[model samples]
Target chain A: MRRREALLHIGSWMVTGAAALSAGRARAARAAPLDQPSVRATIDNLFPDLPIDTSDAVAIEGPEITDDGAHVPVRLRLGTQRDTPHRIALVASANPHPLVATLDLGERFSGPLALRIKLARSQSVILLAATGQRLYAATTFLKIVASGCNPGQDETPPTDLGTIRFRHDPPREGMADARLLIRHPMRVEQRDASDIVSRPANHITMINVDIDGNPLLGMACGQSVAADPYLAFRLRTPQAGETLEIGWRDTQGRGGDARFPLGI
Target chain B: MSLDRRDALKAGAALALSSLLPACATPLRTPPTGRVVVVGAGWGGATTARYLRRWAPSVEVTVVEPARAFVSCPQSNLVLSGGRNLASLTLDYGRWAADNGIRLVRDTVRDIDPERRRVQLAGGGQLEYDRLVLSPGVDFDYAAVPGLEGEAAQARVPHAWKAGPQTAALRARLEAMPDGGVFVMTIPAAPYRCPPGPYERASLVATYLARHKPRAKLIVLDANPDIISKKGLFRAAWRELYPTLIEYRPSNAVLQVDTDRLTVRSEFEDLRADVLNVIPPQRAGDIARRAGALGEGERWARVNFIDYRAERVDGIHVIGDATLSTPAPKSGHVANQQGKVLAAALADHFAGRDPYRDPVLSNTCYSFVSNDEAFNVAAVYRVAEGGKGLRLADGSSGVSQARSSEEAALARAWATNIWSDMLG
Candidate 1:
């Protein structure tokens, strides 16, 4: 949908009183959807035809002021509504590439996900959750003490590339936590101090995990994802002796896979 | 002066009325009733002073420092590579002092009389304090290194550890050296000021040599048995980027330095250099010793980890590199965290509350592998069981997985935030 049409459709999808209140603020933010033209383009491209919901259903938790813009920890809590979102996207508005990551949470996963991302400067970090037909968005502001230097593009990857470490907590009250760490540089095009911009950005483009021969979760990462990217999420009813097959592929066409047994 | 309830209430009201009457011309002396005297205005002392005022608005804070401005030792190594200059690192305390209501005293402590709670100044002055905070950072043990006895000897081969004139001198020496010149630096053992500092210095110097004079060589003589902090990262950088330019020899302790020949002698090898950087083993600053804070023959001062009170002496507390050790590294970040801990403890004590039994401090030291890439070793320290001192919190610390330009940017951000936390 066009920006004007998205704004018009905002009134039709107001589900709760909280959603209506945000719809009012959405109209105010309508004066300028995003400060940067590239950022607006990114948002419009992500949701071309769907009307975005500015609702309390999506929650973003991050530091109000971050000392290190290179790695800022963030958590997103999707609402407890029975209708779980099919997809989630995170964006740092002013980054060289606004889109940080998009996760296809699969049909069964209702998440409280956590990750660390890179920010270029002080700006709004927006989280969007897509429920197939409808989209919900939340935003939080972060002030960078010192802005992150623009990252340099494809350098030689570390020698221990494709190394993966996976861990999971014991099931507690029908919920278990799992974290995955991948050894990838997540290289992106960056400008040097001498104003020299350097090659092809290389980052983990796809991540998929399967448990007990069933699809658990999948994520598509971007350059704004920090190096040695980490992803953590909760699992429901994780059973003993269950096998988890994890696979990921990078922009450079190199890939790695690992198998971790649950309840170890 | 025991009083009945009615009499005490009457006296309190009368005192309150008298205090209100004085507000017309003289502002009521309602400032916090306690006074804290802090010695040495480095990261530790300055942060303690600012935080004491922040936590307890009424408490008077006085800081005695010899230096006119603060020059950060954290990122000073970059000066050798021309990535940053001393001017950019040097900061004035005028604004920070004024805003925090911190009284700045330009003097050094000659001695401390703990019984009288008095601090004697070298400038023929004495300061009485209800509580004394000693954050006098590390003092190099020059006597340990034969032939490097006093100021005259240090002039020839600058330690450049404190990041001031000596740092500038070291940079100038590097600049003036001819091609194929050997730049050798010696690292003191573990428990020095900054664990990864020497390695970072070597890394940056090697970077400069590679860019300017590829034939020049940089030798690292580490006294420790192995690479200490960010070992894998530093080792990899030296191997990958500066394989030919840098030579790292661990377990090589310097025995002596001949300034005339610019040669350093360890037990195994004697190497001559066009420029020599000798970092001497360090102990608590002189004032810490004068205050009788350190135990017999102890290099560092022992303190009650709960509130950081000196163990051997009464009425004195030590923080930073002066304290008798913990798992926390002796870096600016730890000192700043210690300052906040001490300040909060004092605030609690004055408020008739007990200090926190298990205070936690987090430290992060970022070291540059080159001009554009860096890595960090971070830890969260909590009071160990039985409260002897601090230990690394279980699974609460780790080093960066790799070196990258992103980390270098974060390193700059870390320094900027920490410097601001201490003085801004």
Candidate 2:
């Protein structure tokens, strides 16, 4: 019954312009009030009242139809060469929690921000980006069909959680390419070997990267990040011998950090 | 994801009207008259040359290919099981260019002078063009495996990745092997031409062994972590049909090869077999290297995906299996689609107009699992907003739900249609 109300709220929110903004503002602007508190908090911080118009500036790249709904590879480029987006947010309307992730992608980092996310089902995946004052958006519909194998099929989770691996190239053209793979199941509800249902809902909540004590990138992941979440991004002006630190915390209150000594 | 007949006519009319307008200051070619020289007569090059003639008859199109007949690599695997012969797959370009008013040169291109926009032919000649298309396909990186570097070694254990002599030799070797002998085939990592090709070859070979040898075993060594394409269908087909005859080992990249011993060694173990098929890692053919298309240490040519133009060189576009098109597997279908798109882009360029901003490309590849059953994987791509690369079009890509004899018939039809599309 509550799902119906949430659907109606989302429908009204879909209507753009001053009417929808004001209507959404009156309703507390909760994109996914039914989701977890952390996810809801992140959604609230996204300024849902802001108007979003479709623009070609943003690029949301992924498979049109995916067999594995458990993990869908998505690459997001917030803005084009003419426009530099200061922040970007992803929302999948069909997910229990529409808000997937939000990243503070500063103006300097223009390369594609690639990561994997879990889709509940076929839905429209929306990318919202803010360049200067105006907010722009792009939407790509993704269809998730049942795998010919089992549904929710995923690679075996790494035995050790929070194990992070980094692969990066030396600075090129004032930017450095880096890839990160964090070991976490990003588990959804599943039946255990004991025939008992388990819903841990443990997933990476926050991702922080620092280079020599300076913040390089920050991201907040919701329940939708995929298993052993993989991320690839470009860092601006990374130098040799500099220490790069990556830290993440999951919903279970467990946290882990790793440090890499950059080399040429 | 195709332009209809009306759309093609509209584009042609636009070209005609635009050609009447005053020439833009930065036209791609001066005076709007252009010559296009396409190297190789494979799927991509032939399609490009043919479509270029149709789209813009004023632009001279010349195709320089070494082979007399275009042997298709798509359906060549059936040769192993005697389902299809090499002769049946070999398509003749009989006066295709002459009838279309294009030039067809039977020669090899040794080097590409991008600055001068000329290609040096091995038969002691040079062809100058306003634009050059290099669709030379893939060349095996035999040096990556030490023992398989020399010609004699390759002849001893044929890769048969290409569709000509090596394919025939490998088929003969399979027929000659004694009963109960093991046939070992190695699959290179992803980004190779035709992702499902090695598996299809393995399946047909298994079928041959099942019927003729009966006691023989086939081992597939895959470099990838798992089945990369048509995974479910291939696995199910293997389990249902070739249960006892085939063994698949994933993540088994070839570390070394002992051609004389009929052995291949991966990081995990070494296997000796009656037949060793070492499908080595591949890169853009040598002509692309001569054109400075591939970057240092890169295996494939980097192109400006919009028009398939080489990143480092101007007036030279590299297509086909030789290019690195991420998310778009290297295949003849993709090359043919790229050929049409590049042809249209060239037409727009010569007409002093901007190339179509949103270009769509679709690829459909069929893999025959046995003599009578097959499956397919299809994808549709559109130019990304910024035009860096192609993104899968919304809700337009997937694999066949199941394998069937119907799809096998469709596979043959696809081949017949595409062959005519490229060479007709």
lDDT of 2 at A115: 78
True contacts kept of each: 0.00, 0.00
In angstroms, how far off is B100's CA in candidate 1? Answer: 0.6
| Model 2 TM-score (2 dp) | 0.63
- Write down the lDDT of every candidate, Cα atoms only: 0.77, 0.75
For model 2, what TM-score does chain A reach? Answer: 0.73
lDDT of 2 at A262: 72
Per-residue lDDT value at B177 in model 2: 93
* Model 1, residue pairs in steric clash: A1-A48, A1-A49, A151-A190, B32-B58
Worst 10 residues of 1 chain B by lDDT: B19-28
RMSD of each: 19.9, 13.1
